[model samples]
Target: MKLSLKKFIKHFGVLVIGILCMSAGVALSKLSLLGTSPISSIPNVISNITAIPIGQLTIAFIFILVLLEAVVLRRQFSWQNLLQLIPGSLFGWFIDAFVRFFHSLPNQTYIEQLGLVLMGTVLLSLGVFLEVNSHAIIMPGEGLPNAIALMHQLKFAKVKVYNDFILIGISLVLALSFTHSLAGVREGTLIAAFLTGRLVNFFTEHANRFVDWMTPATDANN
Candidate 1:
């Protein structure tokens, strides 16, 4: 029981950090007007069109998308998957709102902007690690990549790249229709893929030992 509690704490902590980091990255990407990854890009596009709060829009859209994914994939519904959305959306909203309060900060010099971008990238990568290590059910956008990997017997990283490309394509169409622009899509592709991919590799390699130790707990639950 003590071992189980310790494992739970570790997993839960990672999960919380991971979800928030992901949302923070998305929020920063949106602020840069550079767009986020494919899954996150949808909410940004909707926010641009409807002028609704991006956080609220994102949360709602993700919930709907998760539902669609479950239906399409015939996945069993899980509370953890649904719960994961809460932190992501709430953190995203907090990021957007927090940045709005400091509008002038993002409008810095090229170097400064680059720093913000890098910081955002780091935060996002941390989030990814946290969430992936959590033994709970995955959120929808993430699940899509996992499903694809499972179906094709490909690496999760490669599957993610494919998913990002899909987002880039969708964002392009949306940008053309809404504002005749694709700044976010372009930037998200170039930056997010590079940073997120590198981070994923780094963490996955370095954390394997730790992950192996936790595997038994996860297996027991299964």
Candidate 2:
């Protein structure tokens, strides 16, 4: 029992670190001032036009995504999916906190902004890898895709790619419709979109050693 508890704690630790990485990724992406990640572009654009906090917007958006998952999943949606709200909400708040932490960062040149995009993508990828490996609840950003993959019997990687593209497209429409030009959908957003899914897959393949060290043998059962 003690060993099981210890393993459980390590599992939770992995999830916590994963969430922090993702939050920092989102914050750094925003701080780039070029654009944010695709999953964040809609909230970031809405935040820009409405002057509301992106984190708060993110909470509402995540709620909507969870609902959509229910719709897509229909009979398959379960209490476990609902459990995602806890981490998802915390994920939003974490983003707000990290954004504030880097709020004082000075403006950067185009190259420097791109550099942040690369770094943020790396963090997002690692976050995603750890999150999946931890075998815990996922934020709706990842959860929705997982649902789609399960429902449609599609490859998770391919579904994730499609999901990312769809989100970027929707965010582009929102930015154009509301802002009448552009907002958070930009080159940096494109960079993140291009890199995130691929990078995540890369980490899942190559970075398993670290995650395995942190993960318990019976993690799959838990």
Candidate 3:
């Protein structure tokens, strides 16, 4: 679909807000001291084991996904796909900044920690929905599954689940091998994995209404 200048600006604004929310969600989840989202678990674990910043690892992980997509869908991959790096890098920086911001908050109780995880889940879901609906650029985490689904002619949802499971497995292996236990994959991660997709769908179903409400009357009339 072609976007008018007004619509393009709206979409771009939503996309940026979504990325900020997603980064904040990740930071909150980490602050909960429970676990992060499945996509971020490996990076969190590695960051803990090594001295590398999670943000830098996140960017590296995104590029690795890009490379994997190219390898698996060589015929379909284009240089345009590398454009994901732009937003992905921005997301990584946001994650670092938000993590620092949230680190100052205290989660002193189990209930408080759980609350943080739940809040993070909602923000993460809304962020994903907005980002997907914006149709601006796809994050590498999402793009990998999309590329695989297209290349294999499979369903996107199922492929996404498989992709998440693979990441969870890798996170488990890395955590166990390096940390001698599960570090970043825990109950909260499991909760996020199970609920995030459904929550995204729920938000996506209502996003149109929200956008309509946000659109100025002049734009609507035009």
Best lDDT among the predictions, by candidate number: 3
- For candidate 2, lDDT tens digit of each residue in 1-222? 255676767767788899899888988888887778888888888888898888888888999999999999999889999998887888789999998998876656888788777888889878877787876677799889888999889998788788878888888888899888777778888888888778878887786777667555645554
Model 1, 91-120: lDDT tens digits are 557657745754566535656655566666
Give the CA lDDT, 0 to 100, for residue 117 in model 3.
Answer: 89
Task: Tell me each candidate's TM-score.
Answer: 0.79, 0.90, 0.91
The CA-based lDDT of model 1 is what?
A: 0.68
- Cα error, residue 63 of model 3, in Å, equals 0.6
- What are the Cα lDDT values of the candidates? 0.68, 0.83, 0.84
Better of 2 and 3 by lDDT: 3
For model 1 the local lDDT of residue 150 reads 69
How many clashes show up per model?
A: 3, 0, 0
Candidate 1 vs 3: which has more TM-score: 3
Lowest lDDT 10-residue stretch of candidate 1 = 213-222
Give per-residue lDDT, candidate 1, residue 62: 67
> Candidates 1 and 2: which is better by lDDT?
2
Off by over 4 Å in 1: 1-4, 75-104, 148-156, 213-222
Off by over 4 Å in 3: 1-4, 211-222
